[model samples]
Target: MKKMPHLSFWQIWNVSFGFLGIQMGFALQSANVSRILSNLGADLHALPLFWIAAPLMGLIVQPIVGSASDRTWNRLGRRSPYILGGAIIAALAMFLMPNASIVVSIMPVLLFGLLMFALMDGSFNITMQPFRALVADMTPEEQRNVGYSTQSFLINAGAVLGSILPFLLTNSLGIANTAPEGQVPASVIWSFYIGGSALLLSVIWTVVKTKEYPPEEYAAYKGLDVKAEIDPQYKGFFGFFRLLKITPKTMIQLAVVQFFSWFALYIMWVYTTPAVSQHVWGCEIGDSASQAAQDAGDWIGILFAGYSLFAAIFSVFMSKIATKIGRKTVYSIALLIGGIAYCSTFLFEGGEMMHVNLLFTQVDVPSSAVLWMFPMIGVGIAWAAVLAMPYAILSESLPADKMGVFMGIFNFTIAGPQILSGLVAGSVLRFFFGGEAIYMLVVAGVSMFLGAISVIFVKPSKSN
Candidate 1:
């Protein structure tokens, strides 16, 4: 067998750069969706349920994109066409989701938000699966770690920009931080506008700058003809499902871990705004009218930004550490740290108890803003591992041509748990935990520890 040529760092970087923009849109969705729903008067208890559309979209779209992209080759290349198409759809969704409130009635606004949320997530999946396959297609086995870690760095860096935009817009850019009851804030509106534009531009950069290896050369590197009968041109309605018959055991094990990890993450994304607003900032649960609660929501964005910043700077180091101690060991330790960090949120007494305070003139500041940043370090390291380790482990055992479809299947684990969490999170919070958001974090912490244990069972690979 001929050895695949190793790509230079610059070659690796150009492909990965698109993730920066993709993550921007994603980070915005994760950090702000709940807040947007709240501002539009969705019940806090029903908020988790609203997120169902996003995951359901992923559950359905990914496999189709994977299978379609696997069979596709054109002037735009195998993945770039999907990448460009998704970015455009997602950017438009970004513009529309928050602006859902501008509609005349609350029902229309709510439906609009859900529709846009679904589109953005579905479009994101279209790009995400292809990008994973792209890395595996271009890189040799030994350098896969570097390829994925670089992508992780770009993901986090984009997240840092996306997550902090509301804070920066209100504080630094002099945009209105609080809106009248039933309206979205100007700060948030502008942030999405800028992020959407950035997202499209970044993806365009990748499409223009990078060229795919032609089919024959790519087949040699991947060690398979992508045109095989198994994946042959998007033939049937349920075509991608054929690959499921021969699904690898390693992927199944890793999927279980992904379930818990993403479940924990979904809880954080859905509840953190309520937790910080009601517990830390002492605002009422249904008080979209209150400026204090809105400010608290912006600060949560800052906290998310803090973690992504840590991840951006820390991902490369974490990958190196994984090499020294073994990827599984490093991943387990990172999750444990993240678990502890999630639990720690329960200990904070809120802004009043915090010893130091920072200023954001338009919004209320959390006294422990500095302290909030620390927990993210744990989450950051784990986030880094989450972004890199599973892909590294799975790629070794997967057939090169089938990578896209398998990657699509892997998302089922993430989507299933998210769907489950949406169904039960509100009820669990109301009946089991008395609606105290802190307890949700406690649940999240325990879930992460379980995820750590589950990931240890990921089938070992020679590359890992």
Candidate 2:
């Protein structure tokens, strides 16, 4: 068997560079979707139900894309074709998502927004799953951690820009941050436009710059018989289930950690705007059209950008830190810190003020709300690990030819918890917490703590 030759740093970068754009689109969605939905007349209690579209799309799309990409070999390459196709669809969806109000005469504003959301997220999953498999495909086992960490750094870099675009557009470019009832703010609408453009161009860069190994070479590198036929049992639609029956133990262990981590993340994405608005800015519940609520929404963007900035910085050190302390230890500590950070939002009174340095400009912001950045620092560290460590560990246990499908199957862990969270979060907010969105974050923190503990049970493959 021939050893897979090590790739240069630039080669690894090209393999994963599309992630920068994909995540930009994702960060834009995460930071602004709740605001958009609210502006389109979604009730506060129903926000979680609307968010179900994102994970449900991933649950359905990822496995199919993964399995199909496994068998697809074209002039564009095994994964690049899917990457390019998904980028086109996602960008189009982004352009249409915020304009739901413009087309309200054709369909209900909320329904149009929901359909676009589902399409955008489904395309994101299609692009993202391949990128994960591409890194594993291109890098040898020893370089897996570095490859995944580089991808994480890029993801956060794009997220930082995406998260801050609305705030910057409103405060620096003099765009309107508030709109009439049932319309998205002009700043947010423009941010989506810019983000969608970036998404297409970045994915094109990756598709043009990177090359996948041809079949005979790939089989040689993976130590497989070049002419051997794939197992008959692992074919077609039912094949995904057959593959699940023989799933790797490491994958099963990691699923528990993924569930809690993603559940917390879903809560954060869906509730953060309202949580900050009502809890820190003193807006009434369901006050999406008010000046205070709009300001709070913009501040939430800054808070999200702060966390992504910290996550990008932390990702640079993750490979080295995991090398010294082990991946499990690093994963556990990061999640523990994030859990503490999420719980800390309850300590602030809305009267404080702070000066934030962003993109070489200083902006004065509410002290109570800006103070949330302190907790974001912790969340950022966890975000870095969450993006890299589990995949680095799981990749070693997977068969090279099946990498795409297995990575897609792993999406179940991510999408399932999010689906469950979306189903229950609104009810939990209304009944258990008296419609106080801030407390939902505390529940997110508790979930992260559980994820931290679950990491201890994950046993890496002997090869690792």
Candidate 3:
């Protein structure tokens, strides 16, 4: 491809706007769902099993959607339609999720909502991939870093709001502080509604304002294959199946890293509240019948927001860092940093009284503030690479025509780790240490270091 003039700042901003909304949904879910599930009476060990729906749905949905979008064309275009569709589905799921505990058989209601959430999530991912491909397809090599950086910025901006919403609403508005047994708080409900609306509106703004280069215009970009050429014989199931075959070596390497990384994250999310409550608040898990459990849930939201806040800031500089060092080396260092953060959870335990400040009558400010803040900073840095590195590497390695399918397969690795974490982390903590939640963080630390080690082996893509 011939070198083109650099994109205007607004051009980069316009193309990346939709991610602002998408991250609102993603951050809310990642930060809050485990808290919601726990409040609804889900056992820690079984929490992962419930989350199974997310990955299971992704496994089925992302590739199919990716392949379909790859073949599609029209006024709406291939990717935009999926983005619009996902926004609608996600909006609906957000509306329904906070109310799940109110319905009959909380487990079933939660599962049904999770399914809807997964559908919406999958659609968003489908739209996301094509936008990424479009950036790579359209931007000059010199500006690719800037384009991706803009997108990551928008993503973290969305996450910042999404992560903070619950705490902001519940604390500031004086919304119903406590729900009846088995019900979600009014603050949480309102937050999801706001997130859903924000998601839809942001996506619409992008759809209306930004224009994708058509196949002919896009073809002008050097090194692009606009023909959408694939082996016609491979349209059938067997042909698709044949393309699906990946080297066992690659699969083993990716699968191991993905498993540990995702497992660690899942453990952190699922157990953080309980850990904080038990170790920091000195509250027994089932002993809280009032607003205490819900309060813990809110703190989790704050911590998540803190991490996302840093991620937004770090993303702006990630590309430069990747360029200065090798991408793999940068990623490895980031994961190690995150691992250190995870392991730091142990220091916060049993030091609650000295750490917390009693600001007002009967009101104690959390003493372990430094513990949470420092790790969150590390998380933010690690997240920059988590968002970009693997996909960047994979994009460089795969053939253009196979991008969607291979990316879909990659999603499985990401989701599979979450599934494993949820299934095992809580039970292991419960069984081994009589329900001490800090152990889960230890597990996460170990897993993160493993992911760092795995980074050493990912060969840099020459094409990229």
| Cα TM-score per model | 0.95, 0.98, 0.89
Model 2 residue 151 CA deviation (Å) reads 0.3
lDDT of 2 by residue, 1-464 (tens): 68999989998888888889888899999999999999999999999999999999999988888888877889999999999999999999999999999887999988999999999999998899899999988888899999999999999999999998999998888899999988999999999999999999999999999988888888888887777878999887787689999889999999999999999999999999999998888888888999889989998888898899999999999999999999999999999999999999888648765777776457666778867889999989989999999999999999877888889999999999999999999999999988899999999999999999999999998322
Regions more than 4 Å wrong, model 1? 105-107, 231-239, 351-364, 462-464
> lDDT tens string, model 3, 20-123?
98888887887777666665666756666776666667767776776776666679765677777777787888888888865655457656556655665666
Which residue pairs in candidate 1 collide? none
Find the candidate with the highest TM-score and give its number. 2
Q: Estimate the overall C-alpha local distance difference test score of candidate 1.
A: 0.83
Candidate 3 clashing pairs, residues 3+ apart or interchain: 1-222, 48-422, 355-367, 356-367
RMSD of 3: 3.3
Per-residue lDDT of 1-464 in model 1, one digit per residue for the tens? 45899889888898878999999999999888888878777898999999888889889988888877877889999888988999999999899888887765656777777788889889988878888888887789888888899999999999999998998888877898788666788888888999999899998988888888888888877667545666353357655555676788888888888988899888989998888877777777566557778778888888898889888887878668777887788778888888999988877755543333335434435565446677888888778888888888788878777677788888898899999999999999999977878789889989999999997788765321
In angstroms, the error of model 1 at 310 is: 1.3
Q: What lDDT, from 0 to 1, does candidate 2 have? A: 0.91
